[model samples]
Target: MTADPRRSRSARHAQPSAQRAAPAPRKEPITVGRIADAALEVVATEGYDALTIRRVAAVLGTGPSSLYAHIVNKDDIDDLLIGRLYAAIVLPEPDPAAWREQVTGVYTQIRDLYLEYPGVSRAALAMVPTNLETLRVGEGILAILLAGGVEPRTAGWARDALSLYVSAYALEQSLVRQRRRNQDQEWVLGDEELLDRFTALPAERFPQTRRHAAELISGTGHDRFAFALGLLLDNLRPASG
Candidate 1:
């Protein structure tokens, strides 16, 4: 049977619309881990400042409300980020004879790792670590202190101090990095340039600073970090014999 011209035209027009009507395939379910991974990607590509619930949700092809089902809020995401990063570290066993060194080493590792994800350390400033991996790192540090004879009270307080220092330092570095990128600069100012600037200061007015220009401008970050760690450990001596 021959089709009517009007019916044929109507069916031809309807075919394209029908083909487009297939429901969008089901999106993979969002999970806490998936949300955290998307958030980290946001952080990696656009610094921590750019990370937001909407931004991460967009990355996951979902809405912010969907993420709420799996994670609490931005703070929760921050904790997850820290937990994710530290989960990769293989902590050394605590040793009494080497506790100070071990603790310092761990702190250095933590600082380096925190620095890797810009702005993550900012969260570390106020967030008490309740995440499993974060707690594991804290436990390792505390174990070192206890093994070395630090009293429990002192060790607890020291943990707070160390955490504060690492977070502050990492935050500072991340800010500086962000500033450098925004300013379109390359390389941190070299020590010699810093020394020259300091050395050029009027000796009569800033004699102390001028005299110590080399000392003030010297030392790689690691050197300064080791010195600071040493100072902290020295003052933390185990209850004076």
Candidate 2:
């Protein structure tokens, strides 16, 4: 009995083509979480200026297109960076009796988170909340204000004001650290020396500056932050009867 050759040929051809076997896509198996972490690393090591899709992709051993599969763009990455930092902030429950302290505590935690990641704060300047974590932080803040008897408009404004103040403060702190890190190792001046120079300025013309030099440069970052925060909190008054 003869086997049918055409049937055998058709069966062979019908089998899936190995030649057409597309090489499994070179996906780097990255997750949104991993990409977000890599973004933070880039900000921490190189500052926010170096945080780009290309840079993050390189850090992740993948291409920018692969990152797009998980993140949308630079703005999206900014949101993630801010979100990552905010995720560490544990906002306190609103206490009407202690709302001022609670609000301060919440922002203090936020500032610390920013400092932890260094340049991540730079990405937060003027950035609207787009991620869940960031929004959660905002909600916590607003709740504190509302509990404090702040009107809706006042609560909203206070929320924005606090966020701006904290982010701006963090951004300035990061920039100073970055500058110091970039300065010449041999030519560095201590903070006291820097203040002394200010005081040493021509006393004839810069009298106030010379007299108040110590006061002007007084306090650590935390001290100045607490002072400024106090000013804001102490002045927030509810509507008078």
Candidate 3:
């Protein structure tokens, strides 16, 4: 299928050295937006650590010097990737009856967007939201929270709470998936192999843990996230008279 003319995914993932060859020759100059978009694509495919000035230029059909004329380095691409991430979120028009639904919808969209560009989630780890687009999102989110009856001071905290919630969780998921992928490939542990360690533990020393081991290991992450959200929303409830 042809790449979307409007939004490009190539930036989300850099071409793997094995899969990559020379980028197709472009007749003219490429804009910063185009470079940023491509960087997002490279991150999505190759991951954050894999992102580099060389790789981004490789995707753009240019060299490092050409890319540097636009982006100073890989960190610049990371900053740009976060900007693209901010673009994906859809904020609600703060309304009373619709506040809950609106906030819920916005959160769900954000969670799903992080899932799309897994690597971009790391950009939130130590990154600041200095970009204008990112600031606009914060403004919109704060408006939604304040309209939902949260106090102005409380609503301020909610902005950080919700934003961090999604990014932190997404980053954890990326780490978990990467770990599991490596484990599956290197040792190829069988189901029984993982179970054997637990089974071998001293029953007398850790009876309670053994009893609930299956529950602890097999519970879904989605259920945990929903539970956390449920608790947050409950805490954010307006005080009673």
> How do all models score by TM-score?
0.85, 0.81, 0.73
For residues 1-241, what per-residue lDDT tens digits would candidate 1 score against the true structure?
8879999888877757435565888879998889878978988888888889999999999889998997878899988888888888778898989998899989989888888888888767688777899999889888889889998899999989888988888888888777776656655676788788788899899999999888787777668778877888888877556
Model 2 stretches astray by more than 4 angstroms? 1-28, 185-189
Per-residue CA lDDT of model 3 for 1-241, tens digit only, reads: 8889545667556566677577887666877887887787788788877778888888888788887777766666777777777787777789976666676677677777777766567776567666677777778877877777888777787767877887888778777677778855655444566566566689999887677666655646777766666667667865344
Top candidate on lDDT is 1
TM-score, cand. 1 vs. native: 0.85
Q: After superposition, how far is residue 188 of candidate 1 from its true place, in Å?
A: 7.2
The deviation in Å at residue 194 for candidate 1 is 2.3
lDDT of 2 by residue, 1-241 (tens): 8989998899887957655766787755798889889999998788788888999999998789888887767888898888887888898888889999999899889888888877677677777778899899889988888888888888898788877898889888977776778756544566688788888999899999888888887789999999989988888876554
Error of 1 at 57 (Å): 0.8
Candidates in order: C-alpha RMSD to true structure = 3.6, 7.3, 14.4
Better of 1 and 2 by TM-score: 1
**Model 1 accuracy (lDDT, Cα):** 0.84
Worst 10 residues of 3 by lDDT: 183-192
Badly placed stretches (over 4 Å) of model 3 are 1-26, 183-204, 237-241
Task: Tell me how far the alpha carbon of residue 230 in candidate 1 is from the true structure, in angstroms, after superposition.
Answer: 1.5
Ranking by TM-score: 1, 2, 3
